[model samples]
Target: MHPPDAPGTEPCDWSWETAADPDEVHALLTACDAHQATASGTPAPRRRPETTRWLVESGSVHLLRHTTGPAGMFTLTARPPSGTDESVFPPAEHPLYLSRLAVAPAWLAGGALVGLRCVRQAVETAAGLGGDTLRAQVNPDLRDTCSLLDLLGFTPCGPASADETGRRHAHLHRPLTAPAADRRGD
Candidate 1:
């Protein structure tokens, strides 16, 4: 379920489902990669066909849509993506991993609201699933993402580590408690 819009943004609808269709997932990720490439001045990496299939098969993929259309997406899973170093995360009873988060370029202009909402959703979902902690490995270059994770109470688990792709990511985590509404007094 999509949460309500923040105080000053357009009315948007956030919806999610377990991704069953690879085509949809591929398209969204492609758009996000192109946007990131433009912003970062690096060419977008070509993704393998198996990557989309892995994303769909490996975890629960959630797609966020606004009244305008698909706005963002994320994945939650018990296992980290293939190259992630497991030692970076802090100990927890049950950890749910958050990965592959992306917001369309159009929605990014509205600030980090979309990304914030996605993290909040992950928190709620993780807690509901009996997860004691929510963990994520994010590219350090994405300043907006790093900032949002920090603002929402996620702390760095350890030093940044480079994946096989040679990109450095800072591992972050937050312990789960009550739902976001209760904790924030919403």
Candidate 2:
């Protein structure tokens, strides 16, 4: 959780909790999907309960909220470098995958810093897990999201690929450095 009025630009009171309730998490995910569909005018593929369970079990499903209410959510998962990642990223660079990040339309009104907070959390979590790279697949249709990732130091790699949901996504990676807390500047 972010302390109230941290060194950032805004004075938002941001908090987060690891999603523990299955039904509650499901409803949150559903709301996020609906929000995305309304914004894009196209429904994003829904994840099954089993998939959500796997995420909750193997990683952390975070529910991000502000002073207003639930603003967004993101999932962070880390594992040893796999097939392509093993080759693309260094062998010692354990990859932390960021997935299912969605910010409600209303939250976007708070400005781009909201999205940056989510990414910062993901980066911090990866560094905590001894991960060397933070990896994610961005849907090409999401121009704003791609631009945000670009601004946050993520670099695109290779071409697009289809996931199990058949959605084409462009892979991106950001090499993780030391924790922000360890830095001198607040």
Candidate 3:
């Protein structure tokens, strides 16, 4: 069974489950695509179902859904790298990789609290998965991405990757509370 939805005064429930297939992954991505389009002034990319299906068969990708609201579903998914450690936390001790973190807009205005809670939850999930630091390549194309991250305790540093492509993305990171040295990248 999944955990309860965020504590909203109005009260709605949210569930979390492992997305077992790529088709399910696509549904989440497609929603993310829609969200990116709505949040940004650009059109969401058309995700080819074939590629999405291929990812599912690859065996490292998984999805989580948060259901219980006008708009429900996980809004977050991670495609773990190949040869990961399922025996351990995070299943794959992927030191660094990409996580398709997304939140629907409908849940924004009426549910900022819920959304923020999920962000924190994501951080906790990453930590529980034995992650040293949670890294996200925030698309700078969306100006507010950095600000939102900043509010959530993430900071931007190290080599940035914006100039190579029209879409700039800075590697923003939030570290765990273990060895303080790990947080300080030299």
lDDT of each: 0.76, 0.69, 0.53
Candidate 2's displacement at residue 9, Å, is 12
Winner of 2 and 3 under TM-score: 2
> Residues 1-186, candidate 2, lDDT per residue (tens digit)?
343344652544668778666555666677766766566565476568877777766547887777766667788876421233434443334777888787755555445356677887888888888887888877766777888899889988777766676656677888887456667566
Query: Compared with the true structure, what per-residue lDDT tens digits does model 1 show for residues 1-186?
Result: 233356544453456667777677778878887887677654565666687787788658777776666777888898877667778777787888988887777777655467777788888888899998998887777777788899998998778866556656788889896556888999
TM-scores across all candidates?
A: 0.80, 0.73, 0.61
State the weakest 10-residue window (summed lDDT) of model 1. 1-10
Tell me the spans in candidate 3 whose CA falls farther than 4 Å from its real position.
Answer: 1-12, 42-51, 54-98, 109-111, 163-165, 180-186
Query: After best superposition, candidate 3 residue 130: deviation in angstroms?
Result: 1.6
Off by over 4 Å in 2: 1-12, 41-43, 57-59, 79-92, 109-112, 163-166, 178-186
Comparing 2 and 3 by lDDT, which wins?
A: 2
What is the clash count for each candidate, in the order shown?
A: 0, 0, 5
* 83-150: candidate 3 lDDT, tens digit per residue: 22322332223443434555545455343444455566667676777766665666666665556678
Q: Number of the top candidate by lDDT?
A: 1
- Stretches of candidate 1 off by over 4 Å are 1-12, 42-46, 57-59, 163-165, 178-186
Worst 10 residues of 3 by lDDT: 83-92
Q: Give the C-alpha miss distance for residue 136 in model 1, angstroms.
A: 0.8
